[model samples]
Target: MEYIQVLELFAGLGGLHIAVNNQKDANIQVVKSFEINVNAVKTYQENFGHDVVSNRNILSLSTEELFRQNVNAIFMSPPCQPFTRLGKKLDVNDDRCNAFHHVLKLLPRSPNIQYLLIENVYGFESSKMRDTMLEILQSCGFYTIEFLLSPTDFGVPNSRLRYYLLARKNKKFTFCKHDHTSIVKEFPYCTCRVKSLNDQASICSNCQREVNTNISSLVQQNAGNAAQNSLVNPGKLHSYLDKETDIEQYAVPDKILLRYGNILDLRTFQDSSSCCFTKGYTHLVEGSGSVLVCSRSVTIEEAYKVYNEFKDTDSEAALKSLRKLKIRYFTPKEVERIMCFPDNYTWPKDISDKTKYKLLGNSVNVHVVTLLVALLLHS
Candidate 1:
């Protein structure tokens, strides 16, 4: 049988691998993954039925060793911290950002590989590392197509925007240009604005009775809009409520809501696409910043909903089962969904929540990689 063989590097939670494996018509198979984080390795092993070589950094792995595996394609999502706007943006000099260099070095020694796919933050295009990687790929007889895309464009609820590069050996691929004017029309859900606690309290008087005055004042001060204070009394005490009620009735106050609005506002220029979800999401979920304070972090079930929205109906039952499994952070199954892994794949059972988060955060979204793979297959 003619099959597509893939070698995945930085394979956090096996998202790319899972997605490729799920494609009914695509003959893609992940032969191995190179990852250094033990937590991520555990999660990757759980879903893919492959043991990730943990604690062994990609830089230490030899090209000859990797070549022995008979890889037809190379898939990677290098560390974006060095190029992320949230980080120092150090580019090639960042010690943690060494994978790209190793990938370039290995390419020359592995000319048999027919395709290369890379995913990263948008800032990569402007970085020296990006230029160098592009140069190496071009020199190695790969035609490249680069684009900035978001899950929202394909109906995923989150605005996770990322940069994707698809290259094929000795073949040309056309780069798709994004039309800024068409975004709002194409993705109406991306325009969802932050809603304030006061606005929510007005609709749910039950919630207004629970909020304390001090917290309300702080929320007002931080969110920057206090005109809706009359909607609720300051001396009320907050009470624990069900998940749906909490989101609908007890959302952060107007003051904090303003900050979330600002965060969402900052994203307007980039169209409806969301900023990348990273290991940083844990911090964002736990923090008191405007983004965290005003808007709730997307839950695992919610993430499933987003993924399902973009997917075909045939996977609905599988998505529901995965969503109902209900573990904090994404479970190996949920992580598989994000990676686009098939329903029958098995995950490692003994992974930690921290590991799951780290691996999923580090993974490439499966749909994104599938598109790149499809381009290569056609090329």
Candidate 2:
């Protein structure tokens, strides 16, 4: 049996590795993985093995060295901070971007590589780096297709809109519904399409609030002004959560709940959506992610009513009222589930929760990447 050899760059937590392993129809093997972060390298080794992943800096890899691997495909999620909206918007100028730039330099010379996939924050589509990348790939006789997709497009409840570029040497993308020039929101002819709660109605039962406008704007800009028609049913949050667990440690602090509780996105077990969880998840307040209301007994509607009643009148009393809902942060394991990591994926026991959150936040959505991997190989 011939196996597809893949090289993973910026392979933090091995998201692409997991995706390759999930392919049942294709014999895909990740021959090598490169990541610079030591802690991430440790976690990758824990789940995968020491032989596959390397902590060697990507910029140091020579074209000859990459060629020696004889990989047919490449998967990469480059340093997103340089391209994220909240960052300096350095594009190709940021020091952190040097590694990806180096890879662009290597690609033209490394003829063994045929299929290539690159993932980054949504802002990357408009960057100079993207322009340079396309130029290089085109020079190498590769046909490329771009996408700005979210996990929701693949039936996962999490909304992590990312930019993806898929290129294959000498072969054009043949998706029947899409042209190569346009960035797509959903996979062609995907069967799991369902309307996003925000698209159809509000995320809350009583609130008329819309989805985060920042994310909505991103979707509009990258998807060529087409409104998101592809959505997911989300099924239930319960599927991603533990059946039962002690809740004391996971409870939101009273001070935090009182100060920013009204603004925090609240999700219930029965509901099907969540905000994107970032590296600042537990440490930051707004834009981090949604907090889970652990109990179905205290309806989210009722919780809002309590906030309105005493929110301005008595701060301490509002804290007491909100506390009744048993609101808490999602466990790291739950975040992994939301990110669509396999049940067998594990972290080193010595890794702190903070480190776990950071690594997972920096990682890719496994389900989304898995489908992309399969599509690229089969194409």
Candidate 3:
């Protein structure tokens, strides 16, 4: 009945908090969470209790004060904009990185914290800040493991490739068979098996060839390829979708569909993969995420073919053809499901859809982090 007390920083919508609290095998509690964005704090408070998250800037918090809370672990998904490809690669010089840099300065002073998990964009591993963090962690007597992983590597249908660094104070990772310095692409363990749609008793043939069935080997390479890694068996989008009464509100406007319809990443009812959903999910079309075709009757290829035919034709004909596909943005609820937030996760009634998308976009994938937390806390 021992509980592991956790402290979460940059706690956006409590993604890392949810991941920590949901570990069934471990009795854990998120003692405190720090977030600066008011909308994010409001969303976190709505889903978790009101007392959980504090609207405090991490740079302002004293390590001595934080350590006094006696938290055994710290989990953070610092702002990735500074390291993301879409932003200026400012690295440590980015003013946004100041808070994370402050935390690094505090780490050496907090001797009570045993476990640390940091989540960031793919580019973070190569950053100067990463180098500095590693130098500090090594000086503090911690064994560290880094990963470049995606939700698709697990059972989630979306591809959100992220960098994670796990550090244990004076202890090696329970599953660290590979070099700690090397970035592991797949989960260190594999218990997922996608059952054959055709044969209930057999694993899918594609998975059979690509995924290693052996767990002791600690390898699950290329499990992120949703189309090819049928072994990982990321289920289709239908399971995550909501039964909306007024679906048109979420549909791509006629103007957008006519202008960007051909470029839209469209997924049919049966498709297992989707692009990374950004804060610009509903607003930006090309790379934000995939738009779902509402009809089960229409295949993705069919929708694409129609768009192809209309690509060069008159605008009126293009508009008519696109509407038939019934393509729409994924609802916020659907986005939450794919992000691996639990069924009970909620937002305040006052939060607009745009704010919801923005907060969720800034969050982490719960299922992926949950598994990583479990491994980090293994004693």
Candidate 4:
């Protein structure tokens, strides 16, 4: 089998890189990665045993320099802060937002590059940046397919909804026909079905009833455990009180209350999925942080428990047990698992926990990426 050469831009901690590595048919090799954070680059290098260019502003790399490696595909997930609705929505004017422009300018120089994949927040679809990106691809004679997908759709418990763009230079590439149907069929594990706002409202009464029934059962099973072990109220403790408490006392907060309170409520369980796991956990100061006021954030072990329970059986017993564990948040390895990264893959052991969290938070869920890549390669 012929292998595909990949150059990953804004590689972060190599989430895309790991997913590409998992491709069975393609000889996926990440020739280079451009990252601005030194710690992130360090972690990337440590995990992949590749030379990651650190602190190198992506705009500074010329088109010739990027194409010098003769890459066949380029995969990127740019910093999403500019496009996220939760943020400033700075769009094209944001310094980070301009990175996509740089990528577009570089693409024309690489004729051998047959494929391009970009991942970002769902808000990217509406942003001016997305329009410009589509226009650039069309001008370059590439066809594109865009979708908003979540990790839960891929059988992962977390509801990480992101925008994914797959572009191909070949005229034969049809976004509608290129195995997206089979991709969805094969990955029924994914909770992120492509549905329009109209279709969501059009669900028949029977479908809605079934959905409600399932949700109610899930809530009753997980809510109690989540309340007893996972939830916490941060507002109750003054900042001064946090400092005064010993590390041990602060590590574990009061059992999370299910009812709404001034904390990270366990009510998140009642909803369909968990919040996007971000590097926010690193900023948490057991007692003082604003993110979550629990004994510890959910750990990798716990995350795995949730994933296994949700994916394998959707069993209430498993979820209840997972809620009771009192570990600090999941390790990077565990996060990798939740993201469907293969167990044998290597990660940088030397990097700080903060960097790992940032990398995982920024990465594309491997299962989804793998499905995309397979479709491109086979189609």
Candidate 5:
């Protein structure tokens, strides 16, 4: 069988690379990846062990190199800042948006590329970038389908809603006959997300009811099934916790526990699930995401007593001794598990915890893209 050769753009730490490799398809090979982040490149190399990751700016990516690789599939998750609501909607004006334009310029020169998959923040669907990308793909002879999807929709605990586009050239090796305009595929009904207790027998992460259909069971059951299983199985928040962890490090800071405690997305070990973990996760708790409550053996009285003493002192130094019986940020490794990366996935030992979190935040949910890759193969 001829191998499916792929090129990854904005390949942050090889999320797409991992997806292509993980996909249960026939003989898939990622020929090249273009990324500018040094740390991300190192991590990608560690995970994928491929020298094909180029440190060169994608804006300067050579079409000849892509052609040389004889690439048939293109997988990209471009920077989303220019189209995000939190950032200035600079669109084409933003220098960050230039990389996407560069990709458009490369497409015409690489007509052999049969499959194109692109992902971005949800806001991208309504932005100028969406219109421009659609136009370019259509002019280049491809039919496209778009959607808004979340990892939860596929059964992972975390909810990371993203916009995606899947495009293909028609069988005649010319323009797809399925109209030049974009076809927005209605997202499938997500039965996998944890919901209110009344909605189903399955335990709701938010409501903590006994479930005949357990979230953890759903994950395990789907894990071994073929690509058709669609593991979007609903699971508990604690479904992601590593079997063991260093509680001392991830424990909530005394300062944060004291002031913004109530607003924090704190969940006990058995809670149904967590919020979306953004790049601002540890830095900001409000809407930035969830923290798992530790199951330490300390008494509630002692924990509160320690908290009060730490609060009374009102100093960073006092916080050093403030050991609560509960709560910690989901470790970077745990986050990786939640995102469906393999157990063996590792990074450089020198990489900081902050960079680890940032890389995961910047990366795609591999399982989601894996399903998309399967679709690209079968479609």
Candidate 6:
């Protein structure tokens, strides 16, 4: 009657917890989730209806007590700030990385841990912390498999490349010590890229009506029977799109346009891909993400005509002439849909829109996580 007891550390918004809970295996249960972000904790509780221990920071968590509880598995996505390319490469020196370091130490203290999964941003695999991580896992007698995977490879349109390490205790996982390059992971099926409105209208030779590449179409390419099989194509991305979303509120403000206006990413209703979004997606518009435009897709060259005209003028002035594009921010619901959260997934009603964007940015891909869970647990 042994059940799977897991500790989800640095569990932001319970993304890992949700994935584990979604596993078909009836024995798996999250024993404790450690999170310090109050907003994330609240959002996790709202959606999960479970209590998480957040009394102290992760480093302060009582691992000695956890050992007594016989926790067998650990799933962690510790802070990526110290390892991210966007920030200074402080690695283990950064205070944010201390929690992850503490977890590494906690593992030896908790000997019963047989399975471990760690995820982080792309740059994490190359950072000095990675070597330390590999050393710790090896010394702990855990066979480790590492890979860099993106949601796009799994038939989800978004491009978010992250690092993952799966390790099992006392397992003969084969690996060459000299080989350190990460392989770009791929799935069995890759879907057709969703063509944007302008790209479709302008490039398509057929004058007839086109399909509004919805979620099913995006997933249908790869998943003949997603309900029964094919972990990659979890075909429900469009379910969470807000039918009555406030377009104006999500629209980028004029001030935002002044700095980041020209770099618009007008995705057609049928588009299947997008750039990685960050916590500052709302505030930092340029490299953060693409927006959905309601009007005919104007080529960047065409938009540049308007942009060049108002390069010196206010961004609002430039936008005045470019109103036909009908640009708007991807609604929070849409963002959630892109992240592959279930349609019924709910966040705190009172949370700020910025917070919503941040939460979604910080969260992991549900499909990707679920697939990894199924593979590792064989559920």
lDDT top scorer: 2
State residue 307's C-alpha deviation in candidate 3, in Å.
4.0
Q: Please list the residue runs of candidate 6 whose C-alpha ends up more than 4 Å from where it truly belongs after superposition.
A: 53-55, 173-184, 187-240, 297-303, 313-317
Where is model 1 more than 4 Å wrong at Cα?
51-55, 174-276, 285-355
lDDT of 1 by residue, 1-379 (tens): 5677888888776777755654456677888888777766765666655553354678876777767888788888888889987789988999867767977878887887888888887688778998888788878888776767765443232345677777788766532344321212121111111224445342234232333222333233321111122222211111111123232232333332222322322211112223344664433542211121122343434544544554355345534433332212223343344333444545466665445555556666665455445545643
Q: Model 2: which ten-residue window has the lowest total lDDT? A: 221-230
lDDT per residue as tens, model 4, 285-356: 222112222334555356445545464465455444444543233445545555555556565566765676
Residue-wise lDDT of candidate 3 within 1-379, one digit each (tens)? 6567889999989988877765655678899999999989888888788887999889888977777788978899988988888889999899999999888888788888878999998899899989998999998888999999888776678889999988888787756467678888877554354433334433334344322232211113222222223324667877777866356888889889888877889886677878888998888887788888877665656656777777677677767777888888888888888888876888889999999888888889887787677677763
Q: Judged by lDDT against the true structure, how good is candidate 6? A: 0.68
In model 3, what is the error at residue 320, expressed in angstroms?
Answer: 0.8
Looking at model 5, which ten-residue stretch has the lowest summed lDDT? 222-231
How many pairs of residues collide in each model? 15, 1, 0, 13, 8, 0
What TM-score fits each model? Answer: 0.61, 0.87, 0.88, 0.66, 0.79, 0.81
- Top candidate when judged by TM-score against the true structure: 3
lDDT to native, each model: 0.53, 0.78, 0.77, 0.57, 0.71, 0.68
Give the TM-score (vs. native) of candidate 2.
0.87
Worst 10 residues of 3 by lDDT: 216-225
Cα RMSD to the true fold for all candidates: 18.4, 8.4, 5.1, 13.4, 7.2, 8.2
Question: Tens digit of lDDT per residue, candidate 5, span 221-289?
Answer: 333212112334456656567888888788888778777654777666665457777777788778777
Cα lDDT of model 6 by residue, 1-379, tens digit: 5467888888887778877776653478788887888888888788766565453587776667678656899888888889777788799889998888888877776778888888899988778888988888888888777778887665566778998887888864442232434443643222223333334342223222232323223333322222212223323333335677676777767665555666766565556567787787877766677777656656545765887688687666676655656667888878876776766778888899899888788888776675565445531
Q: What is the C-alpha local distance difference test score of candidate 2?
A: 0.78
